[model samples]
Target: MTTKKPVVVELYDEIVFPDPSEAFLSRVQGHPAVNLPRLPAGVTLPPPIPVEDASKRRKGDTKDHSLTQWFTNFSEADELLQLAAARQRVQAHIAKLRRQISLIDGQQQQFKSTPEQ
Candidate 1:
């Protein structure tokens, strides 16, 4: 009786396998600037990052709302500025009327009251 040999398969042309060596593993660990947490005495380290894939992003699965960016453009910016200017003008006019009323009240009080002598 003879033992059977294992078969090898290539999944994709772009996918590159790492060299199963301590130097390669250490190089992969140091590739990123991140400092990985220390493992427990009996715990084993997680596998290295898979860079062979076209994109490592899992965020594409979520639905994106464009309204946030769209609304922030401030399409009615000019109209808003015009409204603000009108409000300021109205406030200034009200302040001027209040000052005139106070001045008139002061003059009327002075004329209405005569000297005791």
Candidate 2:
């Protein structure tokens, strides 16, 4: 005896694939799939700024004008200046060492000319 099993079927909404000619026609007709939101008149985001203004707020009457209200504490600047000075000193020391090496090389050359008995 042969038994027949019923076929299971799944149905879905009809999806139309766009024709190449239709796509070109829609593109030529100025149909955009996604549109950008428009901002209201006279509204804008604030301008960018640097890190030095961390402790202050924007000031002055002009639209983009700004100022630093508080003077930076001297200790921080002094420390930075000291660091720069130390770097300069180290560079000078390296230059002096190079000069000393050149002098030693010259002296060795001079001693090389003297004959040993």
Score every model by TM-score.
0.34, 0.35
Give per-residue CA lDDT, model 1, range 48-81, as digits (tens). Answer: 5566442543433222223333334433455668
| Top TM-score prediction, candidate number | 2
Candidate 2 regions exceeding 4 Å error are 1-54, 57-74
Residue lDDT tens for model 2, 38-105: 66799664544554663364332233233222233334456768999999999999999999999999
Best by lDDT: 1
lDDT of each: 0.65, 0.64
lDDT accuracy of residue 50 in candidate 2: 55
- Residue-pair clashes per candidate: 0, 0
Q: After superposition, how far is residue 28 of candidate 1 from its true place, in Å?
A: 60
Stretches of model 1 off by over 4 angstroms after superposition? 1-75
